[model samples]
Target: MTFGWLITRYMYPCFLPMGEWYRTPMDKNGAILKIDLADFQPTQHLDIDPTHHVIVNGLYMPHTVIRHNERLAYCDSMAYRVEIEKNAPIQLQGFTRGLAMTDDTIFIGQSRMRHVLRIPHAFSNCCLDGGIHVYNSTYRISRFVSLPAQQVYQILVLDQDFSLERGGN
Candidate 1:
């Protein structure tokens, strides 16, 4: 995870939260620093879980953050891929805006291409087609699912089916 240009921000600003962007120091222990909202200055250290290693450097601007199981998902639009930090890198493409996890898959919305996707068995640092891809722990794409293009902003996995909602629709 080389997040040299990645940063985190709050999706909703109703409360005017600050220090959303964070920086991971290149120290031995991987310390995190909260970038000042206004000046982009290093304000404080925001400790992440010690169990998972941070691989990427910077985050995408206007990124969305989602957590499933023990991993944190970063929808990096600038990078054009989704990164999961837990055990490995789950590479997604086409500028993801939002994501959701179901009982057996992880779904994401692509803003640039107007599509929604799913990874059957998600893993870290891997790529799949513009469809559903399942991976094993070894980071290999194992399964795949197909979706339609409609400028999806988010994906919701219902009890028995999946639903995609467009961003501007």
Candidate 2:
């Protein structure tokens, strides 16, 4: 996967891969607290239960590392809570930075940048097609739903701990 020596040394916003650990909120016990999907495709629905261990950057914490396997798998659990809550109608206008995850997929969107990225490990097995798929904002994704986290607490990126690896970014 090279683009010739002339362009190898030069790149824009280049990113290198690590062992893979998605920075997300986790409990002191190393378990994911809760996960909510941003359902962009409202017309369609998924039979996903929130009380399950979902994939995150190819790892779903304790079990994944414990299983000695990284296969995309989902299992119902009471330790962690997985929920899918809807958005208040996606406003395609302005720079809206949104984040949400489902039992299978994780979606991060930047409306201002007009880009939406989808990362799925357990949701999809095409690891050969690894990494995220960025789509233009014009495309429809009415299936996004977020949890009612705002009413309970404010989201602060600095206070969040979605990373298991430190100082990588």
Candidate 3:
């Protein structure tokens, strides 16, 4: 199975002020590990492009990985990029983390990095905010809904019959 792993080549403090966090150089990247279940060993490793680390002020933290139509796809959180096995990374608008998909749509979670200093980049110029971005089958954003939260860590797609009023029974 493929697993998302944090590849931190350089060590940094667990906590730091916003300004310091941006200034500090941390070689953080993400990888997809192909694990051999029988021996619990990683048989292969696919690393995210190294250029991502140089383009962003923060780390290239990966959030989620899933199989879609027999292909692997994952999110590079702080870099705001999504990658499919054989496709180029898709640019996004925020600190992307959560990801969910239906037959014809994709949902990506955006988090507000309020305390962290962000340097503007080609992917996104607007300020990061907490929300869910909806995309169509072609991967074009359809809509965005802002939330009153600091971060959106995960997303779960529910069936048509699912209802919160029934307590998800």
Best-performing candidate as measured by lDDT: 3
Candidate 2 Cα errors over 4 Å, as ranges: 1-30, 34-59, 62-83, 86-124, 134-169
Residue 99 shift from truth in candidate 2, angstroms: 4.5
**Model 1 residue 63 distance off true place after TM-score fit, in angstroms:** 3.2
Q: Tell me each candidate's TM-score.
A: 0.41, 0.16, 0.62
Candidates in descending TM-score order: 3, 1, 2
Q: Candidate 1, which segments miss by more than 4 Å at Cα?
A: 1-57, 113-139, 142-148, 160-169
Model 1: lDDT equals 0.42
Candidate 2, residue 95: the lDDT equals 22
Per-residue lDDT, model 2, residue 157, is 27
Model 3: residue 81 alpha-carbon error in angstroms? 1.3
Candidate 3 matches the true fold with a TM-score of: 0.62
Residue 132, candidate 2: alpha-carbon lDDT: 23
Q: Of models 2 and 3, which has the larger lDDT?
A: 3
Q: Is candidate 1 or candidate 2 better by lDDT?
A: 1
